[model samples]
Target: MSVTPARTGARPARWPTGVGRLVAGAALLTAVALLPWLSGTDPALTVLRALSADQDPTPAQLAAVREQLGLDEGPFSHLVHWLGGLPRGDAGTSWVSGEPVLPQVASAFAVSLTLMLGALAVTVAVAALVSARTLYLGSRRRLHRVRAGTGAAVLAALPKFLLASLLATVCGVWLDWFPSSGWEGPQSMVLPALALGVPSGAVIGGLLDQALPAAFNEPWARTWCAYGFPSGLTARNALRRTLAGVLPQLLPTVVALVGGAVAVEKIFNIPGLGRLALDAAMAQDLPPLQTATLFLVLLGVTAGRLLQALRHALLGPALRDGALATLHQPALPRRRSPRRVAALCAAALLTLVVAGLLRDPLHVDTAARLMPPSAAHPLGTDSLGRDLLARLGHGALRTAGVALAVTAVSAAAGLLVGLTARVGAGLTEVASTLPAVLAGLLTTAVTGPSVWGAACAVCLVAWTPYAAQAAALLEEERASGHLLASVSFGAGPRYLLRHHLLPAVLPALLRNALLRLPTTVLVLASLGFLGLGEQPPTPEWGRLLSENQPYGELAPWTVLAPAGALVLLSVLAVSATPSGRSGTRRSGAAS
Candidate 1:
């Protein structure tokens, strides 16, 4: 039997060294640092062509174009151009609108980013509130619990865009309280921020429902309670346990922030990277496309990596001891029952239904646009006369598709990278720690904001931290007695991993992914909203909300439908998760 290790305030066990790891890490980081340059290569080539052009046709012209674009310059010159300092504005003009691409994109990027970040702050704040409420309700009277539960469910069920629309109509228009759209500054951001935040709040609130229960059941909770501690005190300590679980859930939320910003910015006309990327993609401008994608990709990677760092910083010693204990502890038996399976299935199905129902179902037809909720139009029409319901569906499908894909692809990729470190390979090490800051830029370059392009970019960069985590955890496991004993019995790596390691790691993987799923959906929606994904008239959730801003007061449902779907999906995801939630007070407190 495995006995728990006596832990100290020492650094945690980490993965071993390997050259491959270094190379991979170097590749990603180097890519980040040099992405703008590498991505700018083709665009520079075009510039060179324009500069060297004498006649419509000339071999010398091609040569001059190459020379001017720095093709004639040595590798060092190319490198110099690639890393070439700050671009306050563009070196090229917009092929589509004849605008100076750089300034337009730069300003737009600022606006969009402001919207995304502002909304993120609001969402995080609201989620924190909801989580607190869930914790507060846990030990409250039955009546209060019931009320909180119903309210939580309702809040979670409404989609983000839907909530945004309602607020736009009532608070924004009817009340004449807030701006319906156009992010002129912080003041104009009020409605969109609320819309973006409501869904996040719902999701976090629901997670608290699960986490609070689990915390109250942990050994710590029991220990505290047995000591005659006040219920409030016990609950607070238990909350620490719950907070541990919450770590895994936070990563996805950051990803979702990027996506949400895309949508909110578009509606508010807030310029940000997402908006720039979107415009670049639509116009097929390769430079900005790659640059923007690289930014997002870096953001995804950096988010995961930072979260990993925090985990180690906060829980490394505890996790080490817990791992050692878990290794020796007898496997917890699974309860085999039809009821459990049925319940889980029902829960999942119900959530899926909510996501579907809340989808924007808009169809593009100017004649049918922007009608209020009425008999002639079920949910009402948009300014373009499109069926808002169909548009909502389209948005939901796109957002859901991206989230699912990003989670699956990124998680799997992370796992593959992580396992390589078990054998002490160095190559995995460097790659695992890569700080690829230019992910968004590279993504823009590669796919130019095409949905597939953005998804691929996210996958490539997003998986890095997960890989780092899995690798580090396994490294600790490899050093333990359990591994030694299994190896002594002639156990192969594959066998041990499949039978023992996978079981231990599976829960963490699932929990992390649970949070990521909704985040991915929201992120994609935001990107599309920023004009990064899908062509015009596709009516994605973010885009729909953005288009209807002018009429946010007159008929807000158009935006609400899609936004509400996003919020509901996020909430359902959080609720269904096994853990991750807010702090809660315990049963007894000093009265």
Candidate 2:
């Protein structure tokens, strides 16, 4: 079945489409190819270091290396030479390995592809089970859906590295059920796949749970039920409709899985494309890094095209006849105060942070190393015999503090740009597609790994969501009857901005920022786990998890302590966020 814009009442997108998209993709690749030059790193030195770390090469040797790698021709000249070979399927040669880039990248891509496929399977299974359980609960479906959504949020908030460390510790080391840190066989993939898939599955399942109820409430569903159709058949049809609507999200979800696999692959020691990219970035190997990034970008584009086709096929008649209804207005539950819940979570986290601050995080005691919980060190000790409680407390200050700073910056910038600009829809869509991890890689490539780089990386994409939401809120306010009436009364732009738009937008924007706090922390922590955030000996949460992962089997408390802290932070963030719609209306009305 073919779908057309006219039949569906779809407005033409202002963003690049058709051949424009191809040009945009090429421009992005070109920008990535020029990163080494952009960062002002010497290509000859980089190649020499990667090729032979021990060598202190003289000027003669440096010139020879530069000539060999085409660095002598300049970045743009080399880019032209590389692009010229693309039609022949050549991606140049790796500076480090001296092998063709395509073969190395292709081999890594195969591993990553297999891991992604396995993760996809797990995501589908999880989403199906959660969705089915929510639908089958009969009278309690709404309540069950809320609880399930909360659970999913907590699960989805977990950073992949933390989860991987936990899984490896519990399932791999303690139980001996699977290999924790290698790519020996299928069993080795299990922990990594589960670590990657479970969060994504929770996200998809929560979306499905939200969409299914709305679909079941549609007039078509009621008619089927009234026509003596089997309840099961009607339910199945409703599910199909829900899936059709949810299919568009598949592109972002798949892309996220691929991006998230970076930390997961590193933790599990899987030689996937993500790991290759990380290695290449660290070694400053431009050829392999450029090739790996290009392949990843193509993978995302390919997945988007396939998912769009599937959406069209599933939409079929609905698209042609304009029968598909908007799914945004889901059946919502009664709003209740989450302040008490938030307060309780905050108290717990605060207590941990306060108690931890009293102890010394850096003092090493070899005799007390790896000790279980005791009176002196309540949370136990790490491999260095440093108190876990102290480390966790100090780490909390850094993790939560940095996350809060990033969230504030993102929210403010997003609000400012979104309110002033008419181009949010296109810009937001494009910006949202670029993952924070990818941004972090680029930032690290330029500035080297540091907390500042991680913050910059997260800030790069974190603001897009807020901008999208703010722009939407602004548009809604402009169309509201009250706003039009005010304008008719000669209300000026500043008057409307102060009285209507700001009142309506700020509350919702604040809520969005609060809700995003956990994710910011997770991203920062993920960077730390991957050695891109704070360096070791600093006691950052992600670094703590990585440092203690090896001893998870020997002393579970070391890993559990920090992991538990992150979980508490997520719970606090979610609980603190008020309901967006009701809060917005109330605030707007009050103003």
Candidate 3:
């Protein structure tokens, strides 16, 4: 048995180092310097408006405040002043609270770090247990694998906000097992941790499951078995190899964790950096917002680099030398069976959208109020007697539209950025480190709170990861033998990109977009949950959940309808991921 040979081509040059680093540093500084104006509103006016309580401030008063705060000196001057003090642990003063930005961010960061640690511990514990049971202890059973895979996919796809709400409802509202919203004690961390960690664990478990088969069937396994090696030793080595293969991919989970933290902090009402950032954005508090955003970006980049280095150290030469091998590996193909199931799920969603479009969502029928599931209303009626089925249907359409818009913007942006320049790629990775929820909040501040604003906010931070992935994929394709050959045969950049690179890049982009859709839905829902997204009267899933909160006990179905729809949509998206079919195909090919 033979594996495919590595592609023969020069690797693309790594991102700029010496002078390039200086240039990127200068570029980043420039962007940060302009953050005030880029926020879409006049920062000085935003601050002054918030400050004026009883009546609108006069132009004279605004000018006086601007002079008092040094806003009259321009952004460059302010940026230089702030940067000069940054090394001394000074981060200016918050425009809203008038508190020092550094201390405020520090306090919030402490809370965030605690929550992140708790969540990471839970994720590790869960992933370890899953790997043990599925890989080491259990026999290779198809039913067990299928069952576990299905369960993980569902959990992984469930939005953080949805999960957080359910936990809060049960533990805080119903049984009173935990405080739904606070930063009281170690116990307070438990619920938020579970809300975030559960999904992350499922993701890790899925990755482990996908990698184990190949690891177990490696040539070393054959050699060990022939010599009657100890089962424990063989299992240990296989698990180690499996982990080595999965570790590079695992770094991105940190970004997801950061993203989920925003939702967790909001739902649980923890005083973490996520919450602080939200408040700052809502109030247009540029000082705190800038500091917090900068801090978050630094945290993400530092952590990713550290993790990548650790993985490289652990795997040593194999990791360092596998670039071309990884690139040359056959592109994972989808099995037709799973593809059909995914298609059916998509069709069901389309049917709902069609029905929703044909129905009037706002039509009120008081006589049918609070009716449980019946022939007339498949999902029953809400407290206002508005059709729950219609609401759910319409909400699905709205939510789907938002998700598609986000995915489209992010994917297209990512593809262009990834393909064009290495500097852009680096910047994207830095930006990707910011949490999804945090991104939405900041964007809301810049764009103002509205549907398109929320979309723009999401698009800003959401595109980074996709761009980073696209860049990687594009680089790999460029280095592949055929594309490299085309280059050598005098093919121009435009023609090569159009005919060769685009085809290869599109599939990966599509797969990544699908993988990102569930998260995008969750982020949109999280924004609405926080009252920053689609407001009332709009039939969006998050808003629906918010509207039905008051009558949760009396009409569980109202809450259940939209919540169930979100879950179903998420499950469909997850099931449609390349993993659903690609794993099956890979396994078949391996056998």
Candidate 4:
């Protein structure tokens, strides 16, 4: 009989190698980079093709565009053309805007980057300090980890867009802390910064808490104590020792923050990268989309790699020698039915998507566009003749899908980046301090206006959490003797992850993943409502709300259906989670 690899308590691989993480990061980056070019000659070509179905264009105009983009050539030719432009820094001019693609994207980058960086700073400070304090909560490992998870929960629950919108409404419009629009000056950034920073800080705090216990319990921490070291010396010694472990998790956090940049920039009328990307998307400019998507993917991959290298270099021995030995053990007892619940959510979302897509694309039956709910159109039609029910279904599906994907990606990335950043506390503070706005601008400039393109655009900015968590967790894990055993088995970093780190963090990650959905739905819909996500007639929930607002007085159900669905899903998800897991608070920092 064939024998399976025997179960052993080991980490299976050392983190310093991080080969598995690097490969995964590479694959993700490549996919994101290829998206815009793969979709067409930029993302707009699909829309152009769709447009041709409705309206006839002059042959001369079409020919000029085709010639410029080499559309008459083979698909490979367009891809080659795209690849050819990369080294030369020439993404070409915008097809729709008639502007230089780079310039348009660059203009927007300024605003988004500033906001994101600012938020990032707040996130790191809160995570680091809060996590440090959580260490003192003392001895209760599971409770400590749960507390640490809180940072992530808060961040997940309070998405950037929601906070930005609320801040804009209150501080910008009412309190007058910042300008109402057009990012006029530094003063204008106040409300947007607050919106972005508050939630980020909470996330950081939670991650730090998770990392602290592991760090404090390290052999070195005990060593310092055993050596009769003073309290300050021991603490400093612990911080210094864990820097290597911190880098892995901090990188992803940055990427998630970029996603927030769009909303923050938009709310403040910052005209940063998010605004530019939004404008380009509304205009369907292909070149801008390509650049924006590339920039975001590139940034995320590069930052993630950098942190990986650092973690490998510093935490090399412990990960290989100690952590791996402990990861080879058999699976623990199952808690309940996480797989079932996840599947159910997935199925429900898919159903909504199918229903929405099958419904009418155009809600414009001028006679029934704004008609109140009645026998003919139960939910009434929108500005277009499209049924509100169909639109709601589609909108819910898209928003939920994008939100889920983005959240998963961001959480994964955040865990990676946060792990890395914790390695160098001072460096983490400095690196995370850059506003999400800055990263937002850079990535947005890269992707321009396309929805998929925008997702790519934000990935780099989205990776912030990675940097924040790395240092803390690694330090703590190393102290816990896990890192020591991890290496004894000679496993690679990827194997270690499959066996160890991921499982440990899974509970928290899952919670964050679920919490991110509701706000993510709001964010996606907001973008669509603002003319960014799925274009007109696509049946986006946010767009529906915006479209129905004028007629909401007549048919309130139109607004309630989409909003209600969103709320219900969020509540259902919260209920579905096992009682044992309740954000960072319930989990404790050590688990």
Best by TM-score: 3
- The TM-scores, one per candidate, come to 0.61, 0.78, 0.78, 0.57
lDDT of 3 at 269: 83
Q: How accurate is candidate 2 locally (lDDT)?
A: 0.68
Candidate 3's displacement at residue 162, Å, is: 2.8
Clashing pairs in 3: 39-446
In lDDT terms, which candidate is top?
2
Each model's C-alpha lDDT?
0.51, 0.68, 0.64, 0.51
Off by over 4 Å in 4: 1-60, 128-136, 139-155, 211-247, 281-284, 309-591
Q: How displaced is residue 132 in candidate 3, in Å? A: 6.5
Clashes of each: 95, 0, 1, 168
Q: Give one digit per residue, the lDDT tens place, for model 4 in 377-426.
A: 65666665567767776566566667667767766776665444323332
Q: Write the per-residue lDDT of candidate 1 for residues 1-591, one digit (tens) a residue.
A: 543333321123344443453445445544543443455554434443444432344566556545544444443553334335336433444433445545665565465456667766876676666666545644331212322233344465444554565676678678888777666667787787677666666555545444465445444445555676666775565455445434434544555545324444455455566556545544334445444544544455565556556655544454444343323322211212234433554565455445446654434567666777676555677787866655665556666666678888888887776676533234433332222222444676656767776566556556743554455445444544455456556677578788656654555555456554655554454445444455576656555655675576667676566555555554455445443212221111111
Q: In candidate 3, what are the lDDT values of residues 397-469, reduced to their tens digit?
A: 6788888998898889877877654566456546665555555555664566677777886887777655655
Q: Which ten residues in a row have the lowest lDDT in candidate 3?
A: 582-591
| Shift in Å, residue 297, candidate 3 | 1.8
